[model samples]
Target chain A: MDLHAMDRYIKSLIKEAGHKIRNSFLSDISIESKSDANDLVTNIDKEIEQFFISRINRDFPGHRIFGEEGFGDRIEDQNGVIWLLDPIDGTMNFVHQKRNFAISLGIYEDGVGKLGYIYDVVNDDLYHGVQGGGAYYNDERLRPLGITTIEESILAMNATWAVPNRHFDHNGTLKLIQDVRGIRSYGSAALELAYLASGRIDAYISMRLSPWDIAGGMVIAREVGAIATNFRGEPGNLLEQDTFLVANPSIHSRILKDYIRQK
Target chain B: MDLHAMDRYIKSLIKEAGHKIRNSFLSDISIESKSDANDLVTNIDKEIEQFFISRINRDFPGHRIFGEEGFGDRIEDQNGVIWLLDPIDGTMNFVHQKRNFAISLGIYEDGVGKLGYIYDVVNDDLYHGVQGGGAYYNDERLRPLGITTIEESILAMNATWAVPNRHFDHNGTLKLIQDVRGIRSYGSAALELAYLASGRIDAYISMRLSPWDIAGGMVIAREVGAIATNFRGEPGNLLEQDTFLVANPSIHSRILKDYIRQK
Candidate 1:
């Protein structure tokens, strides 16, 4: 595969998708409830997903796709080349705030991530990484994350996870909140991970996230020395929804062992 | 007092201060801890405060200044025209993220909010309001908040407030977190309030915030029909630090009665 040519083509496609999203903000948005009232999907979300699927199929015939909007292929096994796409990551933010959402995409070969991209559509920030190459925030190269104690770190996660839930113990999550310097929730997992790679934040945690949500982020974060794992300190599942913790290598394990207690 | 003229003058001063803050990002920043390690103050913060103080003192000699850096007058009472200034709200974000911080300034006449301004320096978004005049986000007039129930609203607050704390019961806060559509924490009280005024967020809560921390936001929020009060449902203290709850008028009382339990 011509990785360089593919990277250039994918960047242009993501930018064009972003342009479509920006244009949608001017028109009326049709929204619907997904699993719950808070779990929302808009017309633009489905439209953007279809936009990517059509282009990818035309350019790469043999490659398969796994997408958030269910507009792509169903993979029974990790084989050949696969593109994971989340056309609109934070649909709630898109419907409520008209910002804080992004388009996330990742390319993997036989389950190995090779290229990743996350575009903040509203802010025009494109964070992308090539495996074995460095991560870049827009035109600037991202520096590898440095050591930082949990006491001095800023952690980002949804406030919902800290409430009483069956996924993990609320007490441990609350304790972690108190121990950290501060907490932030941007409502988008992909953008939070991009922030981690750019050193805007130290760590990001999510109780339940799908593969498309974290696949692109994992590739970018790993290039900058961030560790991605489930609560059990294992590589997160790339094919199933699971708990996710991506953080600077210095504090990842400490947070998992001392704070995250999964039920 | 001609509020119209004062509004115009204050707007210029805030823009100048914001310009200075953006310039500071290119230079070296010296950071120090205030009350604790997490409570940070940077040289740029002090510089910005002094910058505003010098201009206000020179232009409006009769007005008293209350600032976060203690570089202004020792305000004893709300008698004359007073300028409440935070110079740089979210100083930690300033030193760490290089964004999400703002210049918050509020002008009051005999304890009555007259004018307010919150400048998001990095984004160039200026939110302001005049007494009896509508609020604005940049050039667009902000619409008054419409009704929203607790279950369909988004709440913005620090996650630490949900942990065991002396100011309020953690259980009630946790319950509120579960009931809301979502929760957000942007690390800047002023920007968060600006967001509330613009309808980007439905409510904002803080356990301990000083007058400067919320003075500007209160003016803007109130102009948009949001209610501002302490946990006890009284007008928040304007001269001291206290718990704060600013929400859309529709759900403000319900939240206070059922979810906010002060201890």
Candidate 2:
């Protein structure tokens, strides 16, 4: 398979999708709640998703697509050359703030991630990685992550994690918040993971995240020596939404074993 | 007092300071811990503070300055015209991430805020407000904050607030976390308040923040019809560090009454 040619094609597609999404911001958008009021989905999201699906189908005839807006194929397995896409992650931020959202895509072959791209549409930051080749933030190649202990690290976690919730025990997460040097929550998982890869943040933990939310990030993060796992310290499920914790290599085990308790 | 001329002068001075601060990012920065390992102060921070102090002292003599770096006046009371300055509000972010910090300054007359500015240096966003004049995000005037219920509001708060801490009861903060639509922590109090003023986030809560940290934000927030108060619903202290809660007027009392309990 010509990986370099495919990567270049995907990057151009992502940039085009990003431009379309940004252009939509200039017009009025209709927003609706999915499961709950806080769970928002905008028309622009669907438009962008369909844009990617159309391009992928037209360009790559045999390739499969799994997209957040359900505009792609329904494949239960992560088969050959499957593309995972979240056209606009952080829809709430997009609808409300018109910022902090990204166009995220991950390409996999036989369930193995081959290439990934995440574009912060507003900030104009594009983070992409190839399997053997290194990751790049914009045009600069990202260096491997250095080791950082829990006490010296800053964590990116939602404030709701420490409160009473159905997902995990609050006590352990509470203790984790105290031990870390600082905590940040940018409301966008894709950007948060990109921040992890860029060393802007050391770790990120979220209770429930979909495949597209972390697909591109996981590939880029792995290139920078960061580890992505569920709270149980296992590899993330590529087919469904699940709990996620991505951290620097040195502190990943310590955080999962000591601070995360699955209820 | 020529308030308009002073406002214009301070605005220019802040932009100049922002340029200097941004330029320093290309060079090596010397960092030192303040109260603890996580509490950092950089040479650039001190230099920037001195820069503001010198500009204020030279440009507007007899105007008292209450600055974070101790290069300003040590006045016992907030009498006459006083400028409250936090040269670099998010010093940790500046030292580590090279972004997300702001230059915060609030000008007051006999303890009453007359003008305020929060310069997001990296983003080039300047949020400013004048007494009896409307607030602005860059050149555009900010709209007055509309009512938002707690269920629909996003709270900007530190994750540590929900865990056991020295200031407030964690249990109540935990419940508050669950009650809001979402939560965000930007690591810069001034920018957090600017976010509130710009309608990006609905509220901001911090356990202990100095006068300079929230001084500029308080003025801007008030101009947009938001309310700034302590956990007990009193006005925030202008002379010292104190607990702070600045929120949309609709939900400020509800959060203070239902979620915050001082221990």
Writing each residue's lDDT as its tens digit, candidate 1 over B29-143 gives 8999999989999898899899888988898899899999999999889998999999899997887799999999999989999999999999999999887998999968999
Runs of candidate 1 with Cα error greater than 4 angstroms are none
What is the DockQ score, from 0 to 1, of model 2?
0.88
Candidate 2 residue-wise lDDT, A214-248, digit = tens: 99998999999999998877898889989999999
Model 2, span B1-263: residue lDDT tens: 78789888988999999999989978999989888889999999999999988888898898999999888999689889999999999998987688999999999899899999999999999999998898999979999998789998889999988868666678888888888888889999999999999999999999999999998989999999999998778898889888899999999988888888888
Cα DockQ of the candidate 1 complex: 0.84
Kindly provide the TM-score obtained by chain B of candidate 2 when compared with the true chain B: 0.98
Clashes of each: 0, 0
Provide per-model DockQ scores: 0.84, 0.88
Ten contiguous residues minimizing lDDT sum, candidate 2 chain A: A160-169
